[model samples]
Target: MKSNNEKNPGISRRTFLYSLGALALSGCDGGISAPVTPGSRATSRVSTSGITLAHVANGAADVATSGAFAHPGLLHTQADFDRMAQKVAAQASPWYDCWNVLIANSHARLSWSPRPQVEVDRGGSGAQNYPVLYGDIAAAYASALRWKITGDTAYADKAVQIMNAWSSTLQILGGDSNVDLAAGIYGYEFANAGEIMRGYSGWAAADFAAFQTMMRDIFYPINVDFLNRHNNTDITHYWANWDLCNMASIMAIGVLCDDHTLFDQAVNYYIDGAGNGAIAQAVYYMHPGYLGQWQETGRDQGHNTLGIALGGAICEMAWNQGIDLYGYDNNRFLAGAEYVAKSNLVQADGTYLTVPYVSYTNVDVTQPGFSTASQGTIRPCWALVYNHYVNRKGLAAPWSTKFALAIQPEGGGGNYGTASGGFDQLGYGTLTCTRDAVTPATAPSGLTAFPSAGQVVLSWWGVAGGTSYNVKRASSSGGSYTTVASGIADPLTYTDNPSAGTWYYVVSAQTATGESSNSAEVVAVTALQLHTYLTFDEASGTSAADATGNGHTGTLIGGATRAAGHSRNAVSLDGSSGYVSLPGNVVADISDFTIAAWVFWNGGNAWARIFDFGAGTGRYLFLTPKSSSGLMRFAITTNGGHGERAINGNVALPTGQWAHVAVTLSGTTATLYLNGNVIGGSTDMVFAPWRVGPAAQNWIGRSQYSGDPYFHGSIDDFRIYRGAMSTDQITALVQGS
Candidate 1:
């Protein structure tokens, strides 16, 4: 096993000395490594006494000395240590020292910029220098662990030097200065630094205690002050790219200090829209390479994974401290791990595949792809490691093992090889496993003889050693097909929900080696209508029974002459009845359905029922009448409830002139068109086939059940369709010459 200290060469004595000199020169103004006097104030100090540093150190030392272990603090037995040491010894080289350089540079920056008042871009524009405070803290702790394991005074001295620098320079600013100090609380940059420092405190109890006091008194309070002020506010714009970093850092610090106020505030910010509402929001707000931007770019999976991984790490740290992150519950994190493992990792059979992104067409399944050689191969490996801890600690889920297997690298060649150099040394290993030839299967036979309802089942044969399957469907021959379901390992079958119409299905099988072969195609039929149609006829009915009752059954009373009625109730062309009761009782069974009515009224009233079911539950299509315009109004009740749509102007009803009105419901959207022009539209909950009949009748002139106002206008021809008509279709119907 490679020891963290030994594997990272940047931690050499020379580098340590250089970092110390940098810290000393940066400012000895009671900032870096200044010994604390009894009366001196402390701020942003981190203590390590409570952490299990000894165990961590022993674990690290065990790996370094043995050289055969794979990870530090993971091996349970001495034998396991011996086995991992061999692997490390064979792979160890000077290049491993780069990690140390990173550590040193990171520490030096942390120590000098304890509270960075200004940004420093190290050679690049917009790139801020490492916030060395946390880096120094991490270095000190890592060095202390190294010292405990190897009894190396060099490591101990380095740790002491870093700690002393932090003790003196750590400043707790209040009042106006609090702003400057609080700016340093950028979470991503500082939380890891604090964790590192805290890790080191394990070596010396008194120093750790002092560090804890400094963190509690200085660092934590400033963070609390800033967060309290910005809580539930849109101040995310102020921090710009580092918003998540800042938020996560605050939460981590709050957890460290056990400050419920800050912690709860952060949690509410994330889960309750105070923080970035979704990962996408974070990505959208930041520039590329910024904390959120890296994930958003999507080109470099490694970098994107790092952002998510850091989030996971911080989540774990918070969880360990008893903080509840809203969306990142153990199950969700475990689910993410499962996704990465099953989709992205190279399997043991030498085939690499993973779900790199979510498919826009199908939000459920992750799109799979083979990894490129240029990217860092360690990402999935790291995810696996973190997931392992979560699983082993019983903190995540039992499915973690399954997820781990999905991402575990295949043991043979072409995999990530053990090497000891920089960039060039990171290429793929020798190819040991031969790539399998993939051939697309013929379209499935017996497609025309499928079921008409329930689950649409599709099946195929001939795929051997297959690990999973993907299913695609299209409406017409040679049309575009989309993946509807995936990741099925057995039974060689899939069942799709029945819809109204004929549909086609196709299946593809993926091998354990990551090769995929498409299967033959199949088609199924459904009873539900897939389209809606509409038309308006000026003459139809007058009273509740006449408007909804089939054609001749409707009452032809008074000025409700079909021609006169054309300006009001429109017409019910289909044999289906159109009924209107007082208060508003009306219903219609619509697959893809359209409602056209001519209404004429000029009055201000509440609960003006344009159309609704007698029961007043489930779906409702109604209108809200405004004092300004007797123009027109509409609403839809899908999913479970209802909402309204009202027109902008008050075009007085042309007394006797016929006017057209139509509402169309298709898929999950409902649109209201007046005289062929789109007036309003809204997204419905989901698509459901509604049933309308005598009890569930359609109201034409007034609302029957509840009283507010009744329609006083002519009636006309009303037509309903089995499908939703397009705007063009609706326009033609409303404007027929």
Candidate 2:
């Protein structure tokens, strides 16, 4: 809390919105229920948004899509197939080499037969019979690939036969908790195979219907259920792979069946779901050089590598559907992939390289250090990721590039190993995902601007040759431009503290040789964003002074005391009654706004607010880490809990740790962020400060309900922006960049 004015320097205005979004919080308060102690890996699930169509659409299916979904769009699109066919037709070096490997895989042979199971079980008394499912999944995909690449009807017939056998025979996925694993992993694989072969006319219309019925009936429920409740255990009890595999399956099925609802579920989950598979949780932390430490990095390399495999498949599927999950969060996925690749790939001497790691703790395990178990476990994941970021998009991934090349002509399912892990990815990435390298930055695009109380933030897309970016400003509409800032690196975000007036902004890519053309211009209507900031650095003070010029000093109440903080002294609170009361109407008038803070909590009582502002219990806007309905929530309400509209930050707050949490409202959408990353929130929040009237009970670390517990923790570096803060600005607030 020393001074957060220096935080988020790197946040420049950029395009906005990724999935971490709002779902409705149903049911009003349950009459002051007893406070539940949320331990490690606590549940962050807000609520299920929608049930998949799998529950109802279990009959004979139609042969056509809604025309919105692309055929063969799961992991391998038609374009990818065409590319492979072309490369192999010309006897291309790597493609041909990969083709050789595919032909040699026993699962791809015409003589291969499907071992149908009435019920496929992964755990419990069934003796781990999931192998039949995985092996058949592999054969189906390989046969489909042979059909697509070689135009062989025999392979198509074989693929159809394998698919029909399973569709007609498999009834239920049975087992213990591990059934979820089988549902997710093989579900995606089977759906991918069917997606490719769906266009084959040899696959009878009724036969395809049965296959669709099987997927929707047998797989989607398990996939959606695990994602919704995580076996009704702690949200973090299951690992990232568990979530990712399910997400992958759901997405593949959505594409294969053209069910937009199912498809959106997977996409939304990947973007903002509260589970470990979400982008923010999967790549949990970012180090310097944007090296994101993957969620399972400390668990072990095998699972960590599997995380990459499934994660890459999800991203690629999204990309094939014209969604850019690969570039979300400024290539954060790339950062994670690079970190994992560098760690798992060995040097020439078979020595593992060290990478930066933060200790990871969930409900079940505490990994204080990186685990080398199964280190250097190579998978077919690297090529898809490396090609998308470095070759297709013209970004850089040094570690990923080396890893992809090392395992060039990657093999899928059957070639990696006999286990299910070997088939996690469809492999043959070089045959399907490889693309010629793109040209470097010709000019930057996607420029945007957001203005607040005293500053304007500007951001733009990255270009190939962009070693660094240069920010330009103009008093006029287009220019006579002035170079205000130069040499900004990747994830370009720039804030200019402009004098009060309309301002235009643009950016250009700078390389070793020269600067590129300026990007399209954006206009800022206001000057700055910061309205009120409290560093909470005062030594043993009863009042927290406002660092911003707009006065809104807070009065410490109920024995609120000083504690060691994120930077300096912070406001500490007792669970019984301690809080900080703020000036009336502090944020009761602002339409677009952002509230952010750094808090260290003891992980105690429920319904403890980080901040609450309202006239009374019936009408208030509050942000709490332990909402009765969720882990972290920000809500604006007029009729108490019954009429609350909130953004649920579907992520657990690390107890005994200083973490950043922020909520921003722009238009009707409110986004919640944790530790500078998007978690989840609401998109249709109607309750605003103006709607809530003048808030008289504005308090920090206290709830409006008299019976609710006060937050047991410390709060520091509180900030409020008059206008909606962009992602970069909020990130800057958290990262102090």
Candidate 3:
């Protein structure tokens, strides 16, 4: 194996060993080498035009070198590198365990299983190989970098042995021409070797160049050609493509080797196609494989994890090349990392749950067929290690720290229980946190009330730990309360604006941690009670049936047209027929209520009219032509109140079409019905109140003030309510109809 630290020509292994021993004897600091200042050649800015791209390359190098920054690595300090190395070191034992499973399974020919071919099994059972190599190479380089920083011979020797074994295998595999066989046997192994060597110093320029050439000239072309030839665009399953991992691995190597063309093409294809956004789109278009799978099972876990990881890698590559194809800020890789951390690592209990599938979908209801223990351990181990690296490099958020702490096993067996691959006693010894309780700092001594300017104001002491407050108000002593304002996190005061009524108000406090408790209810009142006024007949004594007063009433007569001089009388309160018309038009007060009435036709071909303007003021309520059915309508123009309903059962009125009709308005909702059944209803509306004046006049068997759809019917028993009447009330009114 090549030593990255030696000065080539004169530095022998013995001299190198002696120098390191001397440094160790001197008790020199061994954690991290001091970071070079900006002016230093090793740390100088690569290029201003493509700063983003340069930073990405630097990030890749940092990842490759166990987070070191002696030369190619940038955007991280010595402390950052040391922290990353420490995390990688801690995972060495676990990596060994997991990798041994792959090594055993691979040697046992499990990779050659025929039931599910290798390509299809790559994610399912064959996933072990790649993760193992990735872990090994990462651990090796990280350990070597640690030794470089600390003058530790043991670390250096171990790194060299690992590298020697890794490099020998790479050389043997690179010599093979059977591309499929080579990749199947050692594809991940090659990626791992290339990644580790990427962090090595340029002093071994010849060996590095040779290794780079082999990867580019042989491995890359063979794999790229194989992938392109076998491309299966029809497969909707994301991981089914053999090139997903291969493309990522090749891109990483190509970027490091400065193969610009390969790098560009890799980026274009992956980001524009197999990248993060692409996977999300695919998932949206194609529902999860298992029905309600997201709710029940963890089947989608592997795809989500792989897509996110690959997305992060591609983003890093694009960032390093100064190409923001995704249109986000220059920190595309960091964005991907944050997204993965938030979606996968963090849990509702404020602890990191290891199952990525659990975070992707609601799973408490649908347990996946796989062993819960496997789901828990595998996901958490992968996520925490990845997150630990991201956090140490300062690429993650503060919230990720909580996730890291949660996934660690309480007594050291691992975070998701005993790690025995069973769910019998899961979540035991886990650290979980819940929303904090809240308590008011001050209690109210007495409730205060005030009424002024048609609005009520109430004030109270501020409560501690409350992020929001809710206020409710009601009319009458024990009426139901209505919400005035909620989730208002402000000074402890509220105001109530109600229509014409005295009301009581109450408040509740809510906290940032989602805790809410009611505060003492307060009382308040407004000065004036506003009333709706109804205008009827103007007080005039007799028969002129004043054509210029605000109220008037009458009966309909004559067929098609009124008899020339046979005057019809307006019925009075005492039922007298002495031309007893009110002086003005009739107006009914219905602040929030239902109105019902009946009309009877006298011999007339014209439809009977119920509501009519004194003059032709463009407002009237009457039935259409008899051939057009006994349909009746009500129209008012004070504020544009309009409603219509018709009898549609084929029930004809005697001679002329005269029938019963009703219109109801209840809090923005209005209904129109004929006889008894409702025909149509309108929601979210306001029927303007009607007004009558002294100049208004009423007419019998004709429009009170105009021509055409005139009433040839007798009108009687018109009533109104001050509030909304129930269906039963309307039903009884219909019986009278």
> How high is the CA lDDT of each candidate model?
0.36, 0.73, 0.35
Per-model TM-score, in order, reads: 0.40, 0.63, 0.34
- Which TM-score value belongs to model 3? 0.34
**Candidate 3 lDDT, tens digit per residue, 609-690?**
4444332222223223242445444433311111121223234444334445556655446666566657555563332222
| lDDT (Cα, tens digit) per residue for candidate 2, span 99-123 | 8878888988999889998988776
Off by over 4 Å in 1: 1-138, 141-157, 172-206, 221-241, 258-268, 277-280, 283-310, 319-468, 472-498, 501-677, 680-737
Which residue runs of candidate 2 sit more than 4 Å off their true CA positions? 1-67, 417-421, 443-737
Candidate 3: misplaced stretches above 4 Å? Answer: 1-79, 82-139, 148-154, 168-203, 217-219, 222-244, 274-298, 316-402, 408-737
User: For this target, which candidate reaches the highest TM-score against the unseen true structure?
Assistant: 2
TM-score of 2: 0.63
Whole-structure CA lDDT of model 3? 0.35
What would the per-residue lDDT of candidate 1 be over residues 446-565, giving only the tens digit for each residue? Answer: 111122123444443323335566778777644477888888653345667745565666666565456454433444444423221222332333533323333313332233333334
Q: What's the true lDDT of residue 490 in model 3?
A: 34
